[model samples]
Target: MSRPVVGYAPGAYDMFHIGHLRVLERARSECDLLIAGVATDAVVLSAKAKHPVIPFEQRLEIVSSIRYVDQAIADPHVDKYLTWQRIGFHVLFKGDDWRGTERAHEMESKLESVGVGIVYFPYTGDVSTTLLRTRLSVSE
Candidate 1:
């Protein structure tokens, strides 16, 4: 606890909405430095079975520009512990949506073994990129 806190929040920031901003801001508030990981287009497609509306570079740039983010990286992997090992984050931040799932349970187990902190922010499911995409596609 004496060491400076480094926070990480990884996501597929497709449309970069206020919800993303809220999480990043909240993460920033809890740590000395905050790193935002933008999921790569290939990773997103492989994992989600759909390409993001905004390209990877654009999404990375957008996340980097946010005031709350100290650094941004393109994440090609889904393993949160691997990311933690690579970045040496003191705390792992995620949306509350993953709070009770198997993935969350797995991550909590891994982080707990290493004494790493895990925090989940309020999920803003109503203001997600999926909803935005659905609304846009209908209009078009």
Candidate 2:
């Protein structure tokens, strides 16, 4: 039997939005299973100035509850290659906004060496957690 294709996406996943769902749907289409990496509190703080409104454990539970997600894991590190090595996923799914960029180029070089392909999906314009947060902040 052939090994099932799996795609991995890592993020803070705070207050999941349409954009996050789009990525999950696209990733599911490209692979049999989708595993999301919810960044831990420490990792989120290190990566961004603002901490997630929803805590890491809640974020993990929320992401895991999504129908499109097969599994959810905590991402202690933001390195895509390191996550891939740890999970052994077949493909890494991310937004096309990162494609052809320096970071994407570096990730491709590293993952390709391990036989893991990278699939960059088209970003859902004007619909992201950041935008949602801004809207909510103004409404309050």
Candidate 3:
């Protein structure tokens, strides 16, 4: 029999929102198992230059509780290849926002070389943690 399709969806997932849920749900639908990688505070700080509004532990807990996520773990690496080496997922799920970027292209090349595929879900443009933070700051 063919191996099960395992998908990895990595994100900071700060300030959990419906958009995040939708991505995870859609990712789960496409794969037999969905692993949500919750970026740690240090990883978020290094990647986005800002710490998450929610604590890493809390964010992890929230993601772990999601019905669509079969597993949740701290994603400490900035390099997707490293995560793949560790997790060995058959596919990677990401927002379409990264679809055409340089980083995404690099990632696509690397992942494809290793027999892994990437699936980009439609980006939820209406809301995001960055927008929420900006709104909060403006109101404050």
Between candidates 1 and 2, name the one with more favorable TM-score: 1
TM-score of 1: 0.93
List runs of model 2 lying over 4 Å from the truth: none
Summarize candidate 2's per-residue lDDT along 1-140 as a digit string, tens digits.
99898889877888888888888887888899899999999888886778889998899999999998999999998678888878899888888878888867988999999999888888887887778889999999
1-140 in candidate 1: lDDT tens per residue?
58788888999999989999999999999999999989999889986789999999999999999999999998887777888888888898999988999978998999878888999999997899889999999999
Instruction: Report, for every candidate in turn, its global Cα lDDT versus the true structure.
Output: 0.90, 0.86, 0.95
Weakest lDDT window of 10 consecutive positions for candidate 1? 77-86
> Which 10 residues in a row give candidate 2 its minimum summed lDDT?
77-86
Using lDDT as the measure, the top candidate is 3
The list of candidate 1 runs beyond 4 A from truth reads none
lDDT tens digits, residue span 1-140, model 3: 98899999999999999899999999999999999999999999998999889999999999999999999999998889999999999999999998988989999999999999999999899998989999999999
**Once superposed on the true structure, which residue ranges of model 3 sit more than 4 Å away at CA?**
none
* Best-to-worst lDDT order: 3, 1, 2
Q: Give lDDT for model 1.
A: 0.90
Better of 2 and 3 by TM-score: 3
Between candidates 1 and 3, the TM-score winner: 3
TM for candidate 3 is: 0.97
Query: Judged by TM-score, which candidate is best?
Result: 3
In the order shown, the candidates' Cα RMSDs to the true structure are: 1.5, 1.5, 0.7
